[model samples]
Target: MTSSPPGLDLDALRKHLDDALPGLVAGPLDAAVIAGGRSNLTYTVTDGATTWVVRRPPLGHVLATAHDMGREHRVMAALRGTAVPVPAMVHLCSDPDVLGAPFYVMEHVDGAVLRDPESLRALGPERVRNLAFRLMDTLAALHAVDPAGVGLSDFGRPDGFNARQVSRWRRQLDGSRSRELPGIDALHERLAATAPELSAASIVHGDFRLDNTVIDTGRGDRVAAVLDWEMSTLGDPLADLGLYVVYLGTPMPAARGSHDPVTTVPGHPATGELISFYAEKSGRDVGGLGWYTAMSAFKLAVILEGVHYRYTQGKTVGAGFDTIGARVQPLVDRGLAALPREKG
Candidate 1:
């Protein structure tokens, strides 16, 4: 059989389990590849007794400076008691001798990720509206959690986090390997010059989006868990909301390179609506958002360009991604200037 992606070798995996479990018998492990995730290999593993999800680094050489499996595990561990719903982390293996790299096991979170507007339309406007509101509320809860209260003082840097972020993503764009995107570089500079002062320090989900969440249809389409934590950090919580809006507002038609398979809503709810929703739930001041939204666009350009870089280097997982890469830059440019200064 073709080599299973990075972390799912069933035959050899059984050999390692004997030692980790000690007399616990794990029968032939069945692995189903969960596609669409960019950084690591996610496998749905079913051992006769229990089901688990294994997350590990991708098979190739990644920037050693980034992709810390240990950090991800630690953050997940710290989020145990908070309002944010997450798949419980189970075990962590850092020894390369065993899994060839660091990996972690987390409770399997079941749900569907919707991306297509048509599918969303099929779900009907009321359901679409409900999902949108729930998404906002769930994020509000995540951003509202106090870092110190959750035992996450070591989680990130709170001081000068806003200015530092501009510098950080700029470096990411510089390191990316690919075609120069439409307005990526210019937008970066603009965002850097116009970076807004953060109101308070709180947990930030660096990359929050529909696909990064598990939507439990059974709970009236409620979000069950926020899945990816590799990018979670401590910063202005408003940035997380800004990122959510950017992900929802991106021009989907061009980004998909074809009809998007997952249902997605458009025009991203006005920043005011989400701001109001979050304020009602968190009782926090969110006076600044326009600039954060601009920053969101800048970061997205770098991120999408990174994807484009990978696609150009032939590392993308699906068809038509190369074209999608081409489309990302324009949105980056538009989003870079989408917002205007809010009335003071």
Candidate 2:
């Protein structure tokens, strides 16, 4: 029998699955942690004949609303048969006794998620450009999905979504503030003053970036599956676009040692190209993007601060946590810069 990894109880998991899933685990189990996700713990498990991915909240320093397993599972399950690719959901376990927290299992997708500039560059310019086009198109496809048709009509509140996001992230920042963060409040206030009217609401992947997806390199334009849906909800679609642009502009530090630099990678589509493509593909106006991008930067700064908080508490369990806090200020500065110059 393979001994359980830290944070996973293999014996209990096997037993629970045997009882809950029936023949899902036919033999001894082995599991290895999947790094890169700072908010959740992901593991790959195999039982001699089959493989699956498991997602659970981080060991400690829990943010109850941010790392919800059920929300992640439900969105993916609802997205099946849609143009947006997502993993096949297998089972959801809510009993904390089985694994010390609720967790879910899904079919393991086989593809690469290029997170850095080097990895993307190795794919050649033409292929990287195609990947970029596909990335934006996929976001358009996701925005086109009807939540009611997919049984997710209640996934999130769409009314006043943009204003709520600003307030919500400020509350999150307040919870994780350890040191002085200049310009964050000013950025948030400006965002509030110029909150865009909700043109239309759709499913928003709170975090949408290159590394958040799996790609079939051979196909170039195919997105095998979109991963990390813990922050997904029914909300303003441009919020997703703004966050994507923010990620493109702000490359995470190499010292933090996660994935490669996305967007900044040579051959990746320019930010203008992405915005134009999204506008053309989704048929949505791009006029309010500046405000959204500022909001995205503010949101990301708060998120990194939370990660830094976990790192300080010794709750994080991977490389790069020590340097993550350093990335917050630059994001805050960028948010300040991205704020809308003209009144909306």
Give the best candidate by lDDT.
2
Q: 212-313 in candidate 1: lDDT tens per residue?
A: 778887678888888767777888887887777666565442233335323344433554676688778878776666678778877777767666676667
lDDT (CA) for every model shown? 0.70, 0.87
Candidate 2 regions exceeding 4 Å error are 252-261, 342-344
Candidate 2, 101-185: lDDT as tens digits: 9999999998887766777778888888888999899999999999999999999999999999888898888888889988888
TM-scores vs. true structure, each candidate: 0.86, 0.95
Judging by TM-score against the true structure, name the best candidate: 2
RMSD to the native, candidate 1?
3.6
